[model samples]
Target: MEIDVEQYKKDLLAQGAEVVFSKTKNLTDTPFSYCGGCGHGVAHRLIMEVIEEMGITDKTIGVAPVGCAVIAYEFWNIDAVQAAHGRASAVATGIKRTNPEKFVFAYQGDGDLAAIGTAETVHTCNRGENIAIFFINNGIYGMTGGQMAPTSLIGMPSSTAPYGRNPDMHGYPLSLTNLLAQLPGTYYITRQAVNTAANVRKCKKAIRQAFENQKLKKGVSLVEIVTNCNSGWKMTARQANKWLEENMLSQYPLGDIKVPKTDN
Candidate 1:
């Protein structure tokens, strides 16, 4: 039977179904711990929605990386484990390997995943770990000052890059999706954002696809979400959104870079 995606979403909204960000039992109420205009909050909500909709709350184990979302375990009401800086993928691999029956997911920021955690992320995908990875790419490190992350765009200014990112000196920013796409173990890889309503919907869909792929015991699935950090970016929440829409989107084109036809 064909599923009516539109009607299904409407029903979920009408039933007062609590997943994330609604009034009752919403994930947002867990606390406004994230900085204003931070993409982590939006990403958090999408993950919660996917878990609730898939009914995998009980069987899911989320690995939270050491970055801005270091304490994501506290906000997400699921089996969450904290990993050392840039080691969430390694931890997630262990958990998924040991508990094959459970669904494992890893969440990490640009610095954690693309910089320090690069080896783990690549090896995990190379091994085809049956897990979902939610990667937040905000260009700058939001937690320990606004430093240049591996994903920071060219000419983008950060605390570490006072003048802006210089490819000659700092090297090119890493493209998480493009890098993972070269690996055969990666069943799905997509780049999404949360700067606008349309993009938010796309991010949720990408996240949902990642979860579904993991449930099917498929290879690794990575969803890189270009999020915002208003405080770190030194812009108001509204201005940050505008900046992302005007600048970030061009560098990080939105869409799935790879997905096995069988998985689709």
Candidate 2:
């Protein structure tokens, strides 16, 4: 018989209404610092919810980066270490290597991961590090004055690219899922979004799978969230959602890039 996991979860929660779910208490009560209509907050909440549901909050160690999620350490009530700009992957590798028992996750944005930290990200995945990377790709630098990021879509205007991202001048956007899927060391890789209820569900499932992949010591797992940066994109929350549907979703079609082979 197919089990109703949602109902089961709800039943469990209903039975202990007064007792806080361990993960719920781990996350901050205040609204996130992310800009309005920003996908970062939605993505963060989903991941946090899954982490709580799985009862892994106590053992998880998050490595936060310098971009919009630099203060992730403040929101997620777990042991966390702050990394320099674009250095979350490197920091995560060190932490996981030193403390193999803990669940290590690295949270970073496009500017931090695809730009300054590209080498570290690629190398860590190449080395088959047992860590999960939650990459938020909003296509521009949200914290640092809306500069064009490596993942910025073509024709998307930014402070640096006033005329939009030019092919000859700026090159192309980076597809992290597609790029990392080719690596044997990467056990789980998926592209997801947080624009709607349906997409949010998919993202949460992917994130849960990523964490499970890490728990099994399979290899590097990455969940690249095609998020929105309303502030940086210079669009209202509603406009940002519409833009994501028309622009971002088309460029970054969501799906799993890789899953561990059972025989492997």
Candidate 3:
């Protein structure tokens, strides 16, 4: 006899399991346009979940930069603005300053954040902008083909680096999140992934904390999600995940880099 998966899920929900999975009200019902096995969808859902849970869906603003997530304004139910390439941080700063009561966040990709927006990112954090930054670090430029990004692994091959990246020539992979943590203006910074169910839960918690920090006016909060770009990596979804665990995790470990002081 075949097992009734749909009924099983219904049973679980009826049993008061508190919905192991459900679409957040903060996102549109339209299906996601991300490539199969892409982590952007997961990251989007997690952020929306946090916003819905916090009951701030109407009071939050998101700034999406030019990248795979540039269309975020269409997906997210809340008010969202599009920023020029690598300029999400600067746009978010202006929005938060002008509307201090609204919670503002910027969603950026590694290429947009670590390279073109480096100056804006550092300066915004240094100035203690009360905004959250959701950084998606997939190591490659997913939107513009598989090109090397500032956070790409040292020896990772990309369209631009067919023979793998040479640290001597390309320099080393930038750890922007870690660098941001060192700034006194930043109150919270963390690196997370969505490779597993457990990791997904942890990521959601970190995102929620970032939102809470904004409500407390605790300065800048940066949450870096080290995700997999299967298509850009030229690997199957499963293979990409495995490769990320073996290689990416070693260079960009998962954990909270910094947290707000309890005494404060």
Candidate 4:
């Protein structure tokens, strides 16, 4: 007889087996369109799980950016709005100001946040808007072709930078998270990765802290998850992940940049 994994897990839950893992209720059943081994799906699950665990599923409002996560509204069960390219931060600001009681967050990619929305991002944190920002930095622009993004490391090859990214001609990789950490308006700022189990747990904790800080009416909280873009990078998922470990981590080392005095 064929065994039913889903039903088996549920039956085990009924028998009071220690709950190892389960899908969050805040995520829709729609299949994700992310490329194989892409971190977007994992990121979505973590965010939804946090929302579900916090009992804020109803009061959460997400602003989706114009990159790979442009269709994020469909994947997330929570109410979401689509922002123009590089305008998620600006749009989220208006949404949060209008609905102060709701939890507001903007999800963006390197191209959208560091490149196009740089002004909005800087001003939002500087003003200390009571909102959270989830940034996914995959080096290259995954959607709309693999172009060289502001967060792309030096010498990284991209469609825009065929030979290689030259700092003299292209400028250095932009560290937006580090920049925002220095701003007094920013209450919490951390960078984590999703490639390893340990890092996933750390990222989840960071995300939880981000939302938790909002209860204190603190300023902007940024959680930057540095991930890999296998499709954009022209490598198999396994190879891309290995490359991310060797190269990406060196440039975007994961850690907390700023935190409240209580955490300090």
Q: Which structure among the candidates has the greatest TM-score?
A: 4
**Mind giving the per-residue lDDT tens digits that candidate 3 earns over 97-144?**
999999999999999999999999999999999999999999999999
Q: Indicate the residue-level lDDT of 46 in model 4.
A: 92
Model 3: per-residue Cα lDDT at residue 198? 96
Candidate 2 per-residue C-alpha lDDT over 109-204 given as tens digits, one digit per residue, 9 for 90 to 100: 988998899999999999999999999998999898799999999999999999999989999998866888898889998899988899999899
RMSD from true fold, candidate 3? 3.7
Models, CA RMSD each: 7.4, 6.9, 3.7, 2.6
Model 2 TM-score, all chains together: 0.89
Candidate 3, overall lDDT? 0.93
Candidate 2 stretches with Cα past 4 Å from truth are 1-23
**Displacement of the residue 103 alpha carbon in candidate 2, Å:** 0.3
TM-score of 1: 0.89
- Cα lDDT tens digits, model 4, 56-85, are 988999999999999999999999999999
Whole-model lDDT per candidate:
0.88, 0.88, 0.93, 0.93
Clashes of each: 0, 0, 0, 0
- Give the lDDT of residue 133 in candidate 3: 96
